[model samples]
Target: MTLDDPTRRRAHRAVVVAFLAHGVVSGSWFVRIPDLRDLAGLSDGGLGLVLAALGIGAVVSMPLAGALATRHGSAPAMRWLLPPLLAVLALAAQASAPLTLALGSLAFGAALGAHDIAINAHGVAVEHERGRPVLSGMHAAFSIGTLLGAGVGALAMAADVAPRVHLLAIAAVTALALLAYRHLLPAAVDRHRTAVRAVPPTLGERLAPLRRRWLLACAIAAMASFIAENAVGEWSGVLLRDHRDASPALAAIGFLAFSLAMTVGRLTGDRMVAALGDRRTLLLGGALAGTAWALVALVDDAGVAIAAWVVAGLALANAVPIVFRAAGARRPVGPDGRPAPVPAQALAAVSGLGYAGGLLGPSLIGAVAELLDLPTAMLIPALLAASIALLARSATGGERLPSTAARSRPAANASPTPTA
Candidate 1:
């Protein structure tokens, strides 16, 4: 089942398509939330609950998605879920009650959870097959797709398109695009040394890895990075409008600038990683992000803060992808004295923590803003982002400067060591 060179290249393209598709689905869905709320007949409070339902579903499914990928192979598991995931988007558009809308959101979140893990699992495999840093480009595709989907959704709204029609159209188009391009790497490519668990590990066994310095560092670093990212997307506009005295229209540009900078940063991230190496790249990114956030918080001017936000976006761009690179790099030694597949559990542990940070970080900042002030609360992300530097070595297990690929090659039969 090993992919030949042609198939490997194709799989790499497929993985990029998958990431883009997922991002489009997400971006399109977020833009239509107001319509969804109207269709569901919800107040702001009910909308919050429905939103919470989505997080709950993601929480519940993330681990389960990892387990499914472990058992069935990420390739097949991804294929199985694609249709249902898109279908949920269409179905949610039609939900006419609070409960039904919540349920549909829950379904959508579950699908998202599965979709994320499968794609990452498959993506890491593809990276291995290619002997280069590829995740950054894949992530860039996602960022670009988000922008594209958001634009489409905005246009749909302007055209007075119904939610049902707009969302259904997005769902159908995304599904077709993914299926048409999904030359996914065979499950065997990643499964070569994996020992499929016949029974689930005990609670202690599951918890044991968290105590590992590397895993703990990875989790903290990832959570910190996500908090910074979510903060940029969620709170930048508020910071612009309320604190910086910007017009609403001008305030909206904060996140757009951030997103655009992120897109550009990730598009060039692979080159940076190759030139500077994982540990150094993260260290520099962390310092830059921390400085950017600090400037945004401390500066009184809107334009200055917004410009700093762009710097923050650029700094945060490759941070999480590098963390994931470490998490998926070389496999642990299995019982047979060979490199095992990267455990799917890593998916649950890493992404689950990140999901929590993304969900809670904005709320936590908002709470602090309520209790104190917006500018003061903004400092929290500055501190959190700075912590990435402190945690970088542990997170990356000390990747060499200038990333010498031959020095970290994987076991026989697998491709070169990941650039992480």
Candidate 2:
């Protein structure tokens, strides 16, 4: 219940609100899956292909999402982006053609990716302004939102509400949340104006910060951790039903447990990071995640396996936020006191990679599960968590370009002001 520092409290609240919206919007789609499959008369593989289209859209959109976010600021971009998402979700629910559904999925994915980039970019900005670690808790709000959305959607389904209708209700809820939250969302504080670009600045002096090995390693760790988180969130229900011999209702509980545990973990992550430091926290997370997966893969009992899934979710919850905070704080300063490199943009690029992996998680898990069984699918997350732990940083400074690197900096847009 204790929020972060008061200076960035509004930003933090905005992040939590946006994430809650994401949970409802994203979860509403999953809630409608049975109807979508029936409406399209899709075989299991066929339906999966449709779902894969959503992932493909997210992958394709991430880079551009980052650029747009940087240029426009998260406030304006998110305002423009979310409406389309609701529309697309509705369209996907009602589409008669596979092509139409595919298109809707693309829009859905694009909106999701765009929202993600804008919000997280905005988050980094807020974190920079606050000079502390708050990203993990914001992300934890996302996990909580997901859990709530899924839970509400499930209850609607139990009451026999049609998928399309259920989604309409969810959309209404999201819209109301947006309206309620609009006034509270923070505006971009970096006031210097520059021409927004369609393509991200690839060669700007700003790109200098990412030249270090540390940045690359952190990026890779983020990618791997995100892949683990997304795979479990998206596929845990499927695994339970298909491999563990659970009823649909029971299988859903597996995902709920996973989501709820993740939420609780993330909610507590800021405190953990404060106490344990990012390195030790990452190490502990990796061990817990790996052990949980190992249990899932090796165990035959349904209840025990579900418990393991929850453990994994909790273990993996805060890992990515720590990585993002580290990445944002990675810029080496030059001697003259200017940022020697494009620190924000570099973090954005690394985040782009992480987002891509997250989008890929579901399809990759599905493909593996199709061939090797659910236990094998579960192993992917274990391996990924271990890799992330290996790559995670021991310590990092706040976003200060080292004094040595500051010597070569171009004058700020005005007085060499930081990025928006």
Candidate 3:
């Protein structure tokens, strides 16, 4: 598609709308969890288990989501998937029993996994058509939505809105956004056009061999970044409250800073990636994130630690998008005559592993904090991010640049001319 093409603009708009809805709703979910806990009369440990259900469900569903996106084009899957997600979101807010919330959380997680894959698959196709960087911008929109969602939910909570009411409002807004943009999603062409054919597989044939070495490497990078980021989300507040004696209200600032920084970073990421290329972008981002963790872990001053945590968000902004771009970058035709490693699969694998680490990060950090201190616990994330930088460096040949021809491609759709 040419830069001036109308269809391309519409496709981009559709993606942005989908992203904004998904982000805001998802962010509000986090903000409302405390209310859910209060309504259920659960303790921190019990609440943790309930939250873990969401992660487990997401991990279980990701592989299936990838397969679904492969068989059905992303647009079709999204139309079917989102309404159910909205229903689950509503159900979660209204659950009366722990068991009910658990079930709702599972459904919510599954929906999220499916939505994540479908949207990314859509993005891969869009980016391919756009020729330049579109993936990062789409992701950036998700962060922006997250920030908005969280703020809205927080405001409602501060105003004494019930969890159900707050969630219902978010759902209404998100559903409206989805409806508004639904028309712009890519229409179903031959699902096989991108590469993978939808033939039934034998019992053993269902599992495709992982041949795209680069994609595997991208997953590894994703694993590192997600693990570190989720750790901060799960543990930073605890550190502030426990070690620094900060009030619960103030402790929340850690995540706010992280989310806000991440949003700004993503919004500007495409420009950076377009100019500097992926390898260097990852290198710089990884270093900044690692440094942020290190400082937050070692510093005693609460203000300093909080500042460091906030800065960490900026460091992390581009890493995930770069990894997504790497995963999504398939040879138009792969060597095996099959569609190359698609973004859906990469996202699934990476998200699954990353969520697992999200669970582990807190547990490990808690153990270390028990033996030494919370600051010492921070060291683990710092080191983990630093190590990820090394892996990314090796994966990308330690700072290779994009080819001149690749750089010169029209800043629009990267697709080949359509057959008449």
Candidate 4:
């Protein structure tokens, strides 16, 4: 909230690490899943059962994140949650059986869910505090991080680096980097000033936002976004290598293309919101992604499929961020004209639901693929992309980024007004 502090800019820059680190860990783990499967010596069905623990852990721990983010703000949560998150990766790397792998995966999922909620809450806080839309860019950092982690994974494989060693090295580097970048916006000054007060929202008050129509709509829209996003993100590699008969090297390009498109879309998302407003931005994103998925469903060629992934990357860049920003901004303004402290709980709830979609998305695709083929399964994402229409009037009507003049005022005056 210290708009004039020299370190304020640094704080914004620092928050991106939370997102980037997560993406790196995730990308690294995803590429190394085969190693994990082999280490555990599990059949595909057994591996699938253990993997469910990850989603379960993520869902179960999110509410706890709500409490932490509300009470402590981003810095403490980011700093503390990360080491455990990093440690879990090493634990999973060393797992030698299904039970051990499942336990490690559960811990990893919990940490991942908690960190994701905390950082995104921070991103929204930073966005409101800075008076510009930075969530999109923070998300872009995640995509870039994924690309970097995947690149590292590829290099490690080429050099014959053991998966356990690769994971440990990345975790160490990321943890050290965390120590160096400890200047995230302070809890005292962060716009969620309820931290400074004797009173914070009651549990009922915090939970009340979830009952609202718009928030539910946002959650559903989030589900759709994740479904569309993962259709390509989770499966394109398999589709290319297994279905399209591409070489291993060529199949890797599927992920690269998806990640690059996401980076491009997110890098531009803030400007898109600034120019067009949230409703239009959401509408455009839905249309573009829906159309792209339809093309992917109809087209049978690998080139067309990869091209569709690119389009989906571009289409969904800002969808989830926009929903999250709105959720954080939903509380009523005070009589004195300062904005309400952002309800980290609300953001967490939406995220919990949104991630449910992410968890379901892959299975949904696989189920469809099993019943028919991968191309026909593409229709599911297309439908979900088109279903991103939960944009109710109460939740997201007439929302636009603040004007530069509005943002130039003092902190109390500059606080983002509740939207609903």
Best candidate, lDDT: 1
**Which residue ranges in model 1 land beyond 4 Å of their true spot?**
31-52, 93-105, 157-165, 192-194, 201-207, 237-251, 298-302, 333-341, 369-376, 401-404, 407-412, 415-420
lDDT of 3 at 248: 59
lDDT of 4 by residue, 31-75 (tens): 666557667886544555565677778877776777676667767
Clashes of 2: 13
Model 1 lowest lDDT segment of ten: 411-420
Clashes of 1: 0
Q: Residue by residue across 325-344, what tens digits does model 1's lDDT show?
A: 66666555422233423456
Better of 3 and 4 by lDDT: 4
Q: Which scores greater on lDDT, model 1 or model 2?
A: 1
Return the lDDT, model 2, position 280: 73
TM-score of 1: 0.83
For model 4, the stretches where C-alpha displacement exceeds 4 angstroms are: 1-3, 34-50, 96-99, 190-207, 330-342, 370-374, 389-395, 401-406, 411-420
- Each prediction's TM-score versus the true structure: 0.83, 0.83, 0.83, 0.86
Cα lDDT, all candidates:
0.73, 0.65, 0.67, 0.72
134-244: candidate 3 lDDT, tens digit per residue: 777888888888778777776786688887888877787688766645555454421334444456433232223233455455666776787677666666666777777
**Cα RMSD (Å) per model?**
4.4, 5.7, 4.3, 4.0
Measured with C-alpha atoms, the lDDT of residue 299 in candidate 1 is: 84
Model 2 error, position 185 (Å): 6.2
Q: Which has the better lDDT: candidate 2, or candidate 4? A: 4
